[model samples]
Target: MFLAWNEMRRNKIKFGLIIGVLIMISYLLFLLSGLANGLMNMNREAIDIWKADAIVLNKDANQTVAQSSVNTDDINGKFDKSEGLKQTAVIATDGKLKENATVFGIDAKGFLMPKLEDGKLFKKNNEVVADHTLKTKGFKIGDELSLSNSDEKLKIVGFSESSKFNASPVLFTNDETISKLNPMFKGDKINALVVKDKNWKDAQLNKDLEVIEIEDFVTKLPGYQAQNLTLTFMIVFLFAISAMVIGIFLYIITLQKRNLFGVLKAQGLTNGFLAKSVMSQTIIIALIGTLIGFGLTVLTGAFLPEAVPIKFDYLTMSIYGIVLILVAILGSLFSVLSIRKVEPLKVIG
Candidate 1:
């Protein structure tokens, strides 16, 4: 430890460069982690809030809620308690004002209808509760919304937070509203069923429909799995690059001090002791630099606009910090092994 600290103090610029590289890497990782989480939240917020164990959809729908359409008669006795949902996208026009929204037609008293963050729940078919994000787009309570597709106009009665669907603002309405807006959606048909029962038997549901767990259902959202995997791969590659950077830097430093290590070995210093110095230096550089990068990331996130959605999950960031430290320690092993190869007699001779 003494040797490591003394050398670091003596070679501040050299060590500082490695720390700088690590700091940049840590910053990117934290930012990416927050971004990945935010995108996921934006994609699955409504589903998570539903808190359902599973949902029922058509077999051919491939677990996609928007693609599945279930008839009321098909699931009559299948679930003891369940709410059917119908969905369609509509352009809400208020004079020159225009807003695109995905509408969910749900039972007024069902568990799927979330408690309003602002106003009262919709009591009539023509009234709707909308995602709070719409408020920022200039929508408010008691404002009438005209659907371009159907003659039936609607009104916003309430707003709910985290009510997004597939990254689009959502409007919660009823079957009667969907029936009017979507010509194909008959009063007897629904897109999917949010089943509340966890003990459903295979034979209980219709032969054409299949059950999907909530987790799997979210992944089926359009472009969700592909986008998530792409971001995940990017983050994983960054970590691998971080480990490689530490290894290469230590290897180069070890090469430069080969003769010094040999001289120390000639004075009876063991390879383990030399290795300990290298490991200590790696840990110090990793831990200190990673924390600094995290601090910078938090500061950056504060100044970012709401349009740039970033959700900092402190627990995951903490885990990644430990991971970076461990990676650096692992990387130092190459230098540790190189130190053991140094010949005490070679340098002195």
Candidate 2:
């Protein structure tokens, strides 16, 4: 370890370059994770907050929640015969305050709608809740805003924080009001239904309606799979780059110390010690680089825009940190493979 430390100290520029590369790659990975998680949360936070055990939609609607429509009668007999039901909808409407908002039409009386950050839920027709961010965007109680895509208008009745779906702001309103605005809706069918009952067999429920567990429904959101896949690729490529950079840096430094290593070997130092020293040096460099990258990410996230869709979670951080250390260690081991081949006799003969 002392030998490794001294060798790294002697070639500060080379070691610094390696650390710089690792820091850049790790920073990119952390940012990508945040964007992916943030976008997903922005897209589905309200639905996740619903905490529904299961959801039912039209089988023909496929993966789109907005496209799926279930009639009131489809769930009436099934809901009453089973346990409970909560119908939900995602509507694209012009903001009552902002110009364009992707609103989530939730039944005020249902399990998904009454969570308020300020004001209250709809108690009468034409009432709606706006996202807290919209409060600054110019929406207030009793304000009537026109929908951009449709001629229908919605009245802001309350405020809430869980407003935003797929990186767009959300509004919570009764199903009737949303249906009244949407021409496709016959004032009867719902976009989706949340079912709660232990006795209700999912397979049987699917026979009558397109039934899927709540968690699964979340993954079905458009662009979710592709976004996640892209982030995964970024993270994987960064990790590989980190490993290779550290390895190559260490290998170059070791080569520079070939004569010194030969002298140490002649003095009876073991190849194992040399390898351990190399690993220690790599770890030290990696730790410093990672800590710096992590600190920068935290600071940047603090001031990011609400619409930016960035989430920094502990699980992701923990996993990234562990992988970073391991990659650095692996890189050191790889470089050390050349250590055993350095012969003292060849240099001093």
Predicted model with the maximum TM-score: 1
Candidate number achieving the greatest lDDT relative to the actual structure: 1
TM-score for each predicted model, relative to the true structure: 0.94, 0.89
lDDT of 2 at 2: 78
Q: Give candidates' CA RMSD values in order.
A: 1.9, 3.0
lDDT (Cα, 0-100) at 302 in candidate 2: 92
**How many residue pairs clash in each candidate at the backbone level?**
0, 1
Q: Which stretches of model 1 miss by more than 4 angstroms?
A: 95-97
lDDT of 2 by residue, 74-174 (tens): 57656522222222333433443344565555656666763688887876766778777567566677678676555667777788875565556677766
Give lDDT per model, in order. 0.87, 0.72
